[model samples]
Target chain A: MDGEQQYIKNVDADAELVDRARAGDLAAFGELVRRYESRVYRTARHILGNDEDAEDVLQDAMLKAFQHLDSFQGQSKFYTWLVRIAVNESLMKLRKRKTSRTVSLDENIETDEEPIVREIAVWDDNPEQRYSQGEIREILDTAVASLKPIFRTVFILRDVEELSTEETAEALGLSVAAVKSRLLRARLQLREKLTRAFKRKGDQILGYV
Target chain B: MVTCKDFLRELGDYLDESVDPQVREELSKHINECPNCWVVLNTTQKTIQVYKGMDPEPLPEGVHDRLIGALEKKIKSQA
Candidate 1:
């Protein structure tokens, strides 16, 4: 039998943590929580734009996932399943605040002329290489936070969380076309914003931080 | 010659590699001669690369203790 895909499969492995977790193994479940908590927390924070709500959603999602372990049929990735729950929980929090960013399907928010989309300024230094890791994190977090929620959610799913475009579409209840359209706008807008922040010889970048 | 607008219109699909071969060919040609268009393609690809490389932030101080404590309570109640 061709068994090259396994680096030698064992009965006990990280990949089988979900199955182990399903069998009422508390340690297994705890490990799964540790593995995914940061991602779940970040997804919540990104959607809700705050720490307190993200922490609540994280707790709720882990508890809910633990309670309903039987429903996780092992078809999709466990993290993806967990993230779907987290995203929904985050959206519920947004709705309660009366400012749900995801209530609509159509994202025609901009007229496309006020900011020139085509004239992208190439960075003088490769900014990722130029900045410290902490600075880069702040820069990216700020830029993403500035995006319209409609686009930010799509970018978070497709780009940050590494979900497939179709998976992102399904998660958000958006069409694949809408996902692509929103992702395009998100990437373009972030590029423009980052360019302004990092363009050559510019003291202009310093003040935004 | 495909206008910069034409390239911008198909930007998403081009990046996704979902464009028709002929249109893809035209876009490739347009990007070769168009500095502004090239900048769009370059910087946008870089933006996604940078974000995707970011490590997820770890749970903040003491949050893990509270979460696990709550989970343990729920598990004990189930017993």
Candidate 2:
């Protein structure tokens, strides 16, 4: 295989391992888990917004994938199939833990958007630049997080994961047109947030810190 | 033959290699003539680049063991 085709094969190779695992091959199953554990957990974490919930979602999704592996025909990549499972698991977890979420759609409260999406660490900087950067990251994160779930998912799958629209559409069961539309909205939203974030951070650093 | 909006609309498709050759050729010609279109192209390119640069968060600690354990338990029960 050429480099690109070889890379694709590396991903497709999971289908073979999955097939073996379905035949009761424990080692094959383990290999599959090792290959995707981090990515699955990370996707869950981002969608669910907490490590505890992310872990639960990952466990649920992995178990489900193992159980349903017999039905996988390799039409979609293993990772894509796995991600769909994880997304469902995370959303289900969110529904289950609905009461615990700090965010409520009904409340028009003026919550700070930045800190909600990203954790802020103490800055070692002379206190000014550090605060500024953290503030920017916060706004960027919040702006990203505020996107409607569908739009946000498209952004995550396409931009962050570098999946093409067709792949994203296949994974999410969306049309290619839907994926493109949502992706454009997501990007425009992020750009607006980033612009506002940097400007505000710049002003704050010069004035307050 | 390509305008700024047309270029932006086709840009993603072009990057994904889903655009037809005619549109691609038109976009190339437009890029050569239009500074505004060039800026949009540059910004969109950088946006994708920055996105790719962000490090994907790793799996939560012990995710492998947890998944494997869960899978084993579920599969065994089914069997």
Candidate 3:
């Protein structure tokens, strides 16, 4: 099916599930949880930075979602609503611990008047070819972890969860301009991390040559 | 013509297809002729692509079962 058809199908399915769940069909609720648990878990994990805390947020968010199923008006997709809960729950945990790292979007990248050419290097090997899947994931996870929570949350929502700019902004309670700014910074930071990794790998290859 | 600075500033919007047609055309033109900006744009695009392709870490089976188990208990209590 085309994208629109698939979206409609998913909406239908979610509506059915939500209706069943609202009727106190625990199995139906479980099905909803099954569909979104991984995504919720990952978002929590990225936000909280640990599996134990993520697990706590996961259960708390899901339980809260279950308890408040009546509040879900179907105006938004169920998953989007659930993600907002998960993000809020994770942030709550961060607040409790007083460990939320906020990065300023106003921070400017140092740009030279003239474009610098020497810093750019043509990567010889595809990153996928240069690293194993596990290694790449580790590198990516570490890189994402390095981002400030604001940028990281934006990155995870927009890039990792594949939410749209509007959805991301709604989830984080930010303006579209703020989402775009943070997302650009997140992407640029991640690119710098990956580029450094690839440049190091390229240097190693040159040594062997 | 869009300068490298102008192109970099709009790079995200260009990739997102949110920029106006005229701005996109200018950015595209600049990237085509400027290798430095091109590499930056290319690598950044690749980075996003790779990140999007990376699999989300699956919820552990134990955690999954435990969550459902806990939720079931909560539902039972409410009932």
Tell me which of candidates 1 and 3 scores higher on TM-score: 3
lDDT by residue (tens digit), candidate 3, A105-151: 33343333222223354454576678888888888899999987778
Report the CAPRI category for model 1: medium
Estimate TM-scores for all models: 0.83, 0.74, 0.88
In model 1, what lDDT does residue A145 have? 90
Error of 2 at B15 (Å): 4.2
Clash count, candidate 2? 1
Interface C-alpha RMSD after superposing true interface residues, each candidate, one decimal = 5.6, 9.6, 5.8
Model 3 interface RMSD, one decimal: 5.8
DockQ of each: 0.56, 0.27, 0.55
- lDDT per residue (tens digit) for residues B1-79 in model 2: 5666676667667655678998888898987887545544544454455556666556656766676777778878877
lDDT (C-alpha, whole model) for all candidates? 0.80, 0.66, 0.81
Q: In terms of docking quality, how is candidate 3 classified?
A: medium
DockQ of 2: 0.27
Lowest-lDDT window of 10 residues in candidate 1 chain A? A200-209
Q: Which has the better DockQ: candidate 2, or candidate 3? A: 3
Q: Rounded to one decimal, what is candidate 1's iRMSD?
A: 5.6
lDDT winner between candidates 1 and 2: 1
